[model samples]
Target: MIETYSIWNLHGEQVDHASSSNAPRVDNVKPIVDPNDQVMGIIQDVFPFASTNINQEGEDDVPTPIDSAEFEQYKKLLKNVNQELYPGCESFSVLTAIVELMHGKIKYRMSNLCFDYFLGVFKRMLPTDNCLPKDHKHAQKMLHGLGLGYEKIHACKNNCMLFYKEHETLDTCPICNESRFKMTSQNRTTKIPQKVMRYLPLKPRLQRLYMSTHTATDMR
Candidate 1:
């Protein structure tokens, strides 16, 4: 049989029309992979005339090494993070401290969930350190002018459905028959929601661009 190949995207969707005349562009296209899909090899076009490792005599093909002095700067940042560790510390603070402390000392294991979790802790920590007015307060103390609003919606504990529109007054999840909250000591269920989702408004987010001096210039 003749040799055959397939192209795919990050979502594991087959790319039927990914042909390109440029070899460099083809190399930049990453193959999409699905968890269950078997991968034979990466899908990219290679030009017969293209050269990769033909180092010219007078020209340097290797990249310059990182400066040894720059490592000290990173070391100092870690010391600062290590100084802020405390009991009952938020995950964000703990992770930030660990990352800063381990900078250059070890490989950083950064991920989306890790970063987002700590970011929330960092934001919460910032507001507690100052006594600025509620309207003037921001986690970074830099975006005091920025404003955002979110709506909290009641959601099922099992995540089977959302109590929206016709189900606003629902006290129990229809599918699971689970109470909206636990029947604790003082009926705390009524005081606090069990599962809540914040709906960030898009209109205000768009408007914030024009309001912020840092982004206003770019928006214009």
Candidate 2:
């Protein structure tokens, strides 16, 4: 029976056990275990190359983090605005207040849904007096321009589904069989309905609000 021994070796370190004649003629014998307690094979010795250790020699450079106080203030402002705008009320004052708050805050980016809600609030808050503020007039002008564009695009082609480019030719109207035709920018010639133009202001007003908010820090 041959005397056997088990030993643990560190990674990449060579172990030699064949120095003596009585140590068993094992050449490059490496540790191997089987399901049964048996020696399985011999393996070549391998060593890993040494590398320099990196030393971090300075104070940890980390940013001064935002404290809970600032975060709480933001949350409180957001909550207050949400409360003022909620329940879907038709009050321009509340909507304007919300818009003002959102404009002041960097977190809230304007969107189409927000614009629609703002417009709804404005419509509800529109005064019986014909006179309007300069801002309101500007907003209205932007809306009217968009409305006119929509109308022009919708007019030349009977159906909104028809591609804008297809409207340029008098060959045939995709929506209706009318041979009469007119062309506008980008080869668009379809005639959009007047009714659809009425809603164009809704998008433009929202766009104006967003633009105004981003362009100026102060709402004035």
Candidate 3:
């Protein structure tokens, strides 16, 4: 891995800069389904946008970047796993609940019946007695397989513009009367961000080409 430093020639003063993807967790992205175009399609179907400042008229109506054909490719990829596997059920809620029980702190003691029920249902889902993939582990595997996801930048709450290189200094949203921060206390009183724009990163693509077993050393 490459390393970087910020302390300079004169006074050793340094400004810190860091970034990360702000997309929702895989579970929250759309429960039990693969984090592919299908999730976008389903979400957009359920909650169709009632006009948006972010796009030209009716542009937001078509949500996913891929057309119908590419989506069918993904749908076909799952047929071997379950011939009857419908579009809505890629993963299992049993796994989701089991994962939640494992990660979260419990108030009740050793013999929780609901927890036992979750484990029982989860065990039943396995084809054999030996093994099953954990939800979070599978999520990590999917994330790594995707190479990387998208990072986000703050946006105007009114959708006037994105607060990027040119508009990073604005305090309030210029288009609307809304303040950039929340109206409540705590971080809201400070200069906290309210909205964001998620976009895919290019650096991970370059890194993946270098790291990929199939592509490394074949620069062209």
Candidate 4:
């Protein structure tokens, strides 16, 4: 017989065991699974955009520039993980949850600012598991609109919120109504204080969504 292990959710609220006998435990947390109760592998740690780039000795390097290829790869990786680990989660909910995990307490403010940067473009981008095709014309348009073309955006360790240029202005989100939100930035980086921002708080809806999606998957 194969040995099994228990997996923990993001909140550390509950534990689910692995379906496969071969799953390994790194940190306490494991990846989400499907309804059929199979081990989908664990959620890979969210790759920080800042770590991808290297600076010359004594030279400062900002976050790696956002390119279409990298963005598409990020999306596919996210989608695959979602399908295996968090099956029932709406794409938006999953993305929001990941963003929340990335940003932690500052999700709201980051959401507001990011919402503004794309003129609310994120609203439409939501509910998508990063599976959009690379050649999709809309993707290019969206990237261009966000000023993401050839520019780098970094996620703050505090809340997973993304930052482009420091001290920027936000207008409107193309996807959601502007009246539903408010925005701000909390700079937390000591070295690049101006360039960094924190993550936002997880809203009640998101919390519920996360719980509902992972509760059952934990059992297998």
List per-prediction Cα lDDT, in the order shown: 0.46, 0.37, 0.48, 0.38
TM-score of each: 0.33, 0.19, 0.32, 0.16
User: Which residue ranges in model 4 land beyond 4 Å of their true spot?
Assistant: 1-74, 77-85, 91-93, 107-220
Among all windows of 10 consecutive residues in model 1, the one with the lowest summed lDDT is 39-48
Please give, for residues 75-162, the per-residue lDDT of candidate 2 as tens digits: 4433332342334433322323433434433256656456556655654675444222224334333222112233333332444343
Candidate 4 lDDT trough over 10 residues, lowest sum: 36-45
- Candidate whose lDDT is highest: 3
lDDT tens digits, residue span 1-220, model 4: 2244344344555544464346666687676644222212222212235133456785656755667765675665445435422335453333233332334325545453443444335434644444332322333342232111233444333433444344133332223323212343456433332233334544633433343434535534
For candidate 3, write residues 1-220 as lDDT tens digits. Answer: 2245323424665444332335555544545555333333332332223113256664545543555643454443332223212234445332233333444425454344555565556657755532333343442332231224687788878788887787777777777756766666764545667898898888867766665434667955
lDDT of 1 by residue, 99-138 (tens): 3323322356745455556555554775464222122122
Off by over 4 Å in 1: 1-145, 186-189, 216-220
RMSD of 3: 29.0
Show model 2 residue runs off by greater than 4 Å: 1-137, 141-152, 155-163, 169-175, 179-220
Which pairs of residues clash in candidate 1, taking residues 3 or more apart in a chain or in different chains? 8-32, 9-32, 10-32, 78-100, 92-118
